[model samples]
Target: MTKSKQTEWNFDNTYARLPKSFFSDTNPTPVNSPELAIFNDQLAESLGLNAEALNTEDGAAMFAGNEIPEGASPLAQAYAGHQFGHFTMLGDGRAVLLGEQISPKDERFDIQLKGSGRTPFSRGGDGRAALGPMLREYIISEAMHALGIPTTRSLAVVTTGEPVIRETELPGAILTRVAASHLRVGTFEYAARLGNVEELQVLADYAIKRHYPDIEDNEDRYLSLLEEVIKRQAELIAKWQLVGFIHGVMNTDNVTISGETIDYGPCAFMDTYDPETVFSSIDVQGRYAYGNQPLIGGWNLARFAETLLPLLHENQDHAVELAQEKISDFSNLYQSHWLKGMRAKLGLFNEEKEDEALINDLLSMMKEHRADYTNTFRALTFEKHDDTALFGIPEFTQWHERWHVRLSRQQESKDSVNQLMQNSNPAVIPRNHRVEEALEAAVENGDYSVLGKLLDVLSKPYAHSAEQEEYCAVPKSAAPYQTFCGT
Candidate 1:
């Protein structure tokens, strides 16, 4: 493969340095008539790439699997995960890590391509990605970043000029995914389960240096790293809950050790305030539902702590005890983070002893009236009007009284608080109905303008643009929507 010189990938592959057992050495299978649909020039520049070069044919070739770029050490990572509560061994079934790029800010990010093509880890499945899901990922991941959550950023989306057969024939595409690191809780699980304690230690040390470098000198560094990850996961789920995001899949493998949101399969933001909002078609039991995310996140972290038992202490019994103690802190961490986020959403400048109860009252009213979750917070951005007009429930009047009383006690000006709430709450999300509408337009009519326009609105979610009011509104009753797992 002829590599490009203008793009300096600077592949400092520490994960690749591990035993071959950790990953399968492979290259992306080439695609036909590769075309560039979108490229993130700012992200490329952050990774020290010439934005102009990436827009050229040479860039399209590299991104489309026609050629592997220089300094790229492509491989399929190995790991074990508990999927939907079932423990199993899995790896990078359809994704390849192209290489790592060091940013000008002295941060390292993995440059990977999803749906590039088949590899040993492909597992008898086509390595190609459907255009709808690729675009959905690009949209949601970028929105998560704009919302100030730790998440993988989409670098590019390339068209393969081919069709992939799923439930029906679909346009094929590839996504350039960038992450702080692809290491996950399941990575440590794989090493520990395989009885490679030495390798587990090596992985732990590498993670600490790469992510939690500030705690490297701690005597119990590995355990401290485990604790830090648990705290981050707690805070992350809290943020997701505040924004009404259902991750759809909380598998250990999808949980990034760097604490960034990873996969976007069957994910959806809530329209109505149902505690059990589930969008993933495969989640029949509501295991990964909106209300269950925090519990599932804790479950996933417990599995991670189990993998680090050996490194927590010398004695097996002592290690087990210490690990359990650290894991127990997840609840406190989650509660604190959740309350903080909820407080912000309510535009509460001062935390009172009854703040939790005040927030719960509003949520209960919302749930009873089936009010729109996003719109409720958004409406709160304005003065408390007779929201019963919007909610269409007389009971909401009582809740409004309680909210006004709470607000009157706060010293901050309502305008200032409203301004803060406006920025904190998004006017637009990657709503399932809108995403489906965009996908249908693109697939059925070859129109990407709708998808492009939706992405533009979601990219700056907090900004109020009267031009996008149609996009912000909940879909009409006629536009019924459903989400499906890409499996």
Candidate 2:
């Protein structure tokens, strides 16, 4: 069932053909004894590739960077970022974009190999990734996709049959990541630093063509592009908040122009309904905490606007005024999207003046009682009010009465309300402890059953099946969970 690599690849490398200044020409360094660890056959099929053709040793070699597929021109993109409120140069240090794959449905996607090898931007670190973290990204990204979040997809994870030294020696792996494009806010920042508007204009025109094609011919296209990007970020962050996802690192580099979630490193879903949840071990200051995501999103967009100010208007004063006007809209835009989502999560199809208060009040109660975020929502979705953990409280009893009264105002049937809540609230998430267990079993004993089961349960986050029941059990330990940016 294997086909020639050229025929199945369908690459049209437009990015590689872009101006040479945007990226460094570098192919992935070959690995030793490449072997496939996991292949996403379903994702492959969705991308209009022959799954059987790629589910082979040859495919493993390509994924491992031991064999370059035809039509692939690998390159590392250059960019700069404000990492934790401090400006610095950054780029794809250990990653290389193979090329854009043209799907049967006429959609284009960037097929990049992460952990490929050292690039020009490698700054002083080893250009390699560990097997556990690669697998972790695969699991969490796929889980996020299932939850209806816009995110870069994992095509495969190939073990290099080599070891990488992190804190200790670990098995090496390469992740084949598929994305809309690799353009980030930092990319524009890099372009703006060229000491002239020519490079910046080129980048802006290309970005508008690639992402906001409809706005390409608009008179105020540049400003419109900024607004569109702002709108997408607002909507994207709202989705993240609705699911309780803490990005842990909200640097401008990670804010994609395509508005898709990239870089799964150090990201996790909230277990407890606490807004100040910070999971990254390095985030001692609660800067990128769960509650701070929307604000950070706005800050990142403002940086993007700063890069586009010259293009936004001819006059300096007018451009500053225009940029300020659009950036200010992020607040109302984000609140609209977030409140709408929060309302849906509560099964309130219609808006009311007290909706925000109701939502905030429930969150307050959950925070006070330390209710498991997923479990509390699932309890309400299933109408299990007798569940003592959330329901057996005098304060909550009052909230419950108010909630029911709110529900009575709607004409929607009980079944409809349940359906909305069920769809909005996931029954399971990639719980940190369970994820650790899966990764440990696979990396230590070469047993993938635990990981496979977790993937299966997570693939349908909204489904309340018996398989999900065990996975949904709240964590027994109260110890704070910490995540690492291993990639």
lDDT tens per residue, model 1, 1-487: 2345576556667778877878998788888888887777877888887788788777888887678877778899999999988888888878899878877777789988899888786788898898888878888898898788899999888888899999998889888999999999889889888898888898899899999999999998988998899988988999999899999988999999989999987888988888988878888899999999999998999999999988888898999898889889999999999898788777887789999988888888788777788888877776544432345456666767777898899899988778878877787888777888887887678788988888778888888678667776776584434577675
> How many times do residue backbones clash in model 2?
0
Q: Give the TM-scores of the predictions, in the order they appear.
A: 0.96, 0.98
Model 1: runs farther than 4 Å from truth? 1-3, 384-394, 478-480
Q: Residue 275 of model 2: what lDDT?
A: 92
Instruction: Say what the RMSD of model 2 is.
Output: 1.3
The lDDT leader among the candidates is 2
Put down candidate 2 lDDT per residue, 156-261, tens digits, no spaces.
9999988999889999999999999999999998888775688888888888988999999999998999999999999999999998899999999999999999
Error of 2 at 436 (Å): 0.8
**lDDT of the structure predicted as candidate 1:** 0.84
Q: All models: lDDT?
A: 0.84, 0.90
Question: Which candidate number maximizes TM-score?
Answer: 2
